[model samples]
Target: MDMSMVWRQWLTRHDRVRDALPAVPLIVIAVAATAVGNSAWHEPHWDKVVWTALSCVPLVVRSRWPLQVALFTLAGDLTLMTVVSHTSPTPAACLVAVYTLALLGDRRTAWIVGFVAAVTIAGVYSATHADSVVGGAGLVRFDFALGATVLGRTVRSRRDNLAAAKARAERAERTREEEARRRVTEERVRIARDLHDIVAHHITLVNAQAGVAHHLMRDNPEQAYQALAHIKDNSRAALDELRATVGLLRQPDDTPGSRAPVPRLSDLDNLADGFRASGLDVRVTRTGTPSPVASSTELTAYRIVQEALTNTHKHGSATRAAVVVDYGAKGLRVTVTDDGRPGVPKGAGTGHGLIGMHERAAAVGGTVSAGPRAEGGFQVVAELPISPRSRLTPA
Candidate 1:
């Protein structure tokens, strides 16, 4: 798009064009200087001008073969110096070659080549002209060569540092993106577990109530009406809870603080009454003095109880169930047991309900165990932390 950008792209694609362009100005300067200077024979030396121009020609491929180019340029400079018997044209071509070698070649090789070039140029210049070494001409040439090498090395180091910094920034960005995705997946799983527990519990009660109403439609009209009323109440409750659970997907700013409160340990009494209304004799008891706990822990405990009871209703022949809550210094423990004869086979329904319970407890740094008692009943016990210490990973 931009003219400068287009020029840069063209230069990058054409290596010879880029490299040869710089040498053009240096060649012009060297030839002009040599042609104008007075020679040892009191005339212009066209041979010195030719040699100087030839020395700068090798600079076109300095990047491709740095050491060989540097040596060739130095030899040209030496020949010109010997023929002129006076101060030679400023060795611009040799300086450029040494800079390229330092920038592209290894440090050890650059140092060795730079040292030899400097010593040979300085020694030859001092030998040719009287008092040139003492007059500082030799030292000036030596400094120019070494200074170009140092400048090239410094530029190379800066480019390397920039590349490394960019790489680190890219890696950090990728890590942040991965962490955000992981949190989103975890939130989705949590919502799914909540929906499973809510729908399964209330639907089971409604089904049982509908059956009772159907069986007693003619023989017991009054009880039939009562059973139908229970069904209506349960269906309404299910819808309310379902709406709340699904509302988690809404934008946070849409209806701040409008979502239903999460169920807590104190709500166990109402939960038990719902089971009682569904024809199950339910009892709830608390042992230690209840103390405040984390909201996550309370939610986990509630879900564990709800899932255990739902499984018992759907798969067990249990009519009597008990819920126990014990508050200890470290955490809260919940236990649910039912005295039901084995109604469904051992591996009855898809065991997702039990799995949900386990996941909920483990998320809050807790553990859950559910099994049939030796005395012919099913039991679920969960130990939840007051403040979650560490979350357990699910298998």
Candidate 2:
């Protein structure tokens, strides 16, 4: 359709033509030199014609089998120089062969070929020419071979260096892809944990309130009204918290009221009050003056307490539960325990409740332990680091 598009299509369709193009110039030079040499001598013998054709044809296939091509070209040129007159195109073809040998072969092979070329030139000149002048001509031919060998070696080195650089670039790209995948997996796990905590706690309370309203609808109108009100309140609160958590996943420009404040340690008292309304006798106590902490650490402390209390309500079979917070110089420690019957087994739900708590605490450079208390019920204890030094340190 367009000129640029047509040009690209042509290039793609003619890849084989591009690969064979470089040899065309070398072929032309060899043929022209042979023709000129024949004209100068005023003779066209069969042996000279055959030798010129052989020397030039090998250049066409040089790239496909550089080593074999060089060997054949060199052998042909040597035979022609010995039998035919020295004014042939053998000298130029021999130079091209030496360059190919050095480029395709290793350093050791190049050195060996250089030695053989030098010896052959000197021997041929001494046999054909009868003076010191031939020695100078042999030296000039040897120099050409040496220069071709050096040029080929330089090109080979550059090609190797480029290949190594490309390999390194590819490896770095793979590593970056792996790192991106790992970060995405971690973010997904965090969102799952947050969603679970938000929905499970509030929905559980809503269910309890709905059941209360259903049973008292006919006999106790006022109590039923209050129960219905509690259900509405719990559901609304759950929606608010869910919105806050999910907003974190939205683009900054797409977020809906992303400025909503996240729950922190200061909100634990209100949290306990909500649970108390749901028939969980929740008590909270604190010791030591609370010190400043990172926002993430504060959020982790709050979630740990929240998950523990939700578990107690569902599985502990406890009438009373207590939350204790101890703020020390190094860190903040929070513990939740319930006085449930030891014989009552834990709930049959997935054990992700405890796992979520552990992951939250670990994310904030903390440790959490959750299990049945030796004396009576279940307990959860978590210690979260708060010092500035701990905040800057890697997990």
Candidate 3:
């Protein structure tokens, strides 16, 4: 109902222009024919006046039924030639009709229709023409016939061009859509992989702790309570990170009642705390100036840290882990390294943990490389570009 809304609707929909073809050519032909008819006759009366009027009827369904219109025009011209022998603008109408038919039909059909109209017009002029049909009437009968044929073909050609343009536009749109969908799908897979790496580790920890509790409950009550506490903390941390990682699927601006917030660069601290509570000795450090980056980039950074910590918890047989967040003018760098020992019982080398870290880093124009430290343990290094967050947030 609103003007802007209507404009938006039209802008989004491309079919309107293509569908208006029937009216444009028909209107032009009508106006031209009327001018030519009046100029040719001194008086208001002419046999073609009736024929011309009849031509108007076919325009109603010109686009929906081009073939039928072409046939009707041909028949109308012939009937006019017979009935209004003394007053037909036989040359003009014949050619115009040919052009119309050609425009509305396919290349081959248009040609055939044009040829028929040409021949029919030429025959009528040659045999039953007025004494003044050509020389006195200044009638270029063949030219008119040919012109009409050409007009129909040209309209059809233009229509084809328009259709092709539409197709290309549609194809471009489809490609954009598919590309977006693919990226989202990839993000989902990355989330799944992160959940696998992080939550799986915690679940593993929970299972391990549960076993320790069961074994120690009979032998030592205090040790059993500590192990049970570890399981609870680990389980809760797993739930929180899982919620944040999967929250990407949610619509951020969804109407009113929605599920969760889309995690941004700001959510990195929460991510860190969850890992810390999961029984990893994770100390987050920062240096240099931090620039704002896109939401996508922020999410990547968060996931990288999260995955890195999960790796440490899973594989590090050592006790402490450190994360250095460096914000430079051009980009951000995160180095997550542990002395490869969680003080706990497990080791962290094999799985999608590192793979997920690399993916998240690469997504935001960053790189991740992880391996056993030359000194003793494992280290993961990631660097990402910082696109100012202010530029990315919606106004």
TM-score of each: 0.86, 0.83, 0.54
Question: Using lDDT as the measure, what is the rank order of every candidate, best first?
Answer: 1, 2, 3
lDDT of 3 at 220: 100
* lDDT by residue (tens digit), candidate 2, 1-395: 89999977886677545434544565555455555653374334555666666676676666566677767777877777777755523355666767777887888988778667766765665566553424677667667777888888999899999999999999999999998898778888888888889888888787777777888999998988988888888887888888887777888688465535788888999888778777889999999888888888888888888888888887778989999999989999999999988777867879998999988877777899988877888989998889423322211
lDDT of 3 by residue, 154-265 (tens): 7677778999999999999999999999876776676576667556656756776787788889899998998888778877767765666555566777443332355565
Which 10-residue span in candidate 1 carries the lowest summed lDDT?
35-44
Clashing pairs in 1: none
Candidate 3: Cα lDDT at 26: 48
Find the candidate with the highest TM-score and give its number.
1
RMSD after CA superposition, every candidate: 3.6, 4.1, 11.0
**TM-score-based ranking:** 1, 2, 3
Q: Model 1 compared with the native: what TM-score?
A: 0.86
- The superposed Cα distance between candidate 3 and the true structure at residue 353, in angstroms, equals 1.6
Model 1 CA deviation exceeding 4 Å by range: 38-50, 83-87, 130-135, 218-221, 342-346, 390-395
Cα lDDT, model 1, residue 96: 89
